[model samples]
Target: MSQQDPSAAPHDDRPRGDPWHAFGYVVSGVAFYGFLGWLLDRWLGTDYIVAIGIIFGAGLGIYLTFSRFNRALPPDSSHDQHEQN
Candidate 1:
């Protein structure tokens, strides 16, 4: 008699997605930094800095993604700490 669709996800309490967010962070970071690096290279007439910028961007993006998604578990209550087995 269950009305729920069996083919759908079983849990309705699932949290929001992170894959797209992570992808966006990385792609945007690389693109934005790449552009800046390209501009800087043109201005300074350098050849290797663009690679550095891309690398930096990717690293920053990964850091951001992790920082955004990581969750700390809630601390146990004092009542629980004193509970008997």
Candidate 2:
């Protein structure tokens, strides 16, 4: 059996999450807000149009960003990459 060197540093093997999920979430949120705001404007007869859309879209974007950040997993420090035995 090969022994590990005491002076050598430990390795990390962790799966990094993809960033496209965030982009997709932001895009979807924006589209949803836009559609909802338009419907609200038509129903409420508000002179100020698209303001709600901008606000909600921005808010949803921020929410998505935070959600993605929180959901992302931290890097693994263990050198164990499992394979089917």
Candidate 3:
């Protein structure tokens, strides 16, 4: 095998990812929370819980999307440094 080049650009092996994951997270969160809210509204006889649930779900979805797709990363250093080499 040929020896690897030393001066070549670093290989970004990380997956570039897709927008669908975030969409799914947000959509799924809204759906799940909305369903829960409907149930709660039925049981508690409160009409506002559905709206609150939707808002909460949106926020939760964004948080989860960031926490997940944003990548936990190799370490805190990864935040500051993009180039591994």
lDDT of 2 by residue, 1-85 (tens): 9998975665433324567766776777778887788788889887455577867887888786776566654554443343322
lDDT of 2: 0.68
lDDT of 1 by residue, 1-85 (tens): 8797776533333335659999999998999998899999999999887888899899999998887777554555643666843
Please, what is the whole-model Cα lDDT of each candidate in the order they appear?
A: 0.79, 0.68, 0.79
Clashing pairs in 2: none
User: What's model 1's overall lDDT?
Assistant: 0.79
TM-score of each: 0.67, 0.52, 0.67
RMSD of 3: 5.6
Stretches of candidate 1 exceeding 4 Å from the true structure: 1-15, 73-85
Candidate ordering by lDDT (highest first): 1, 3, 2
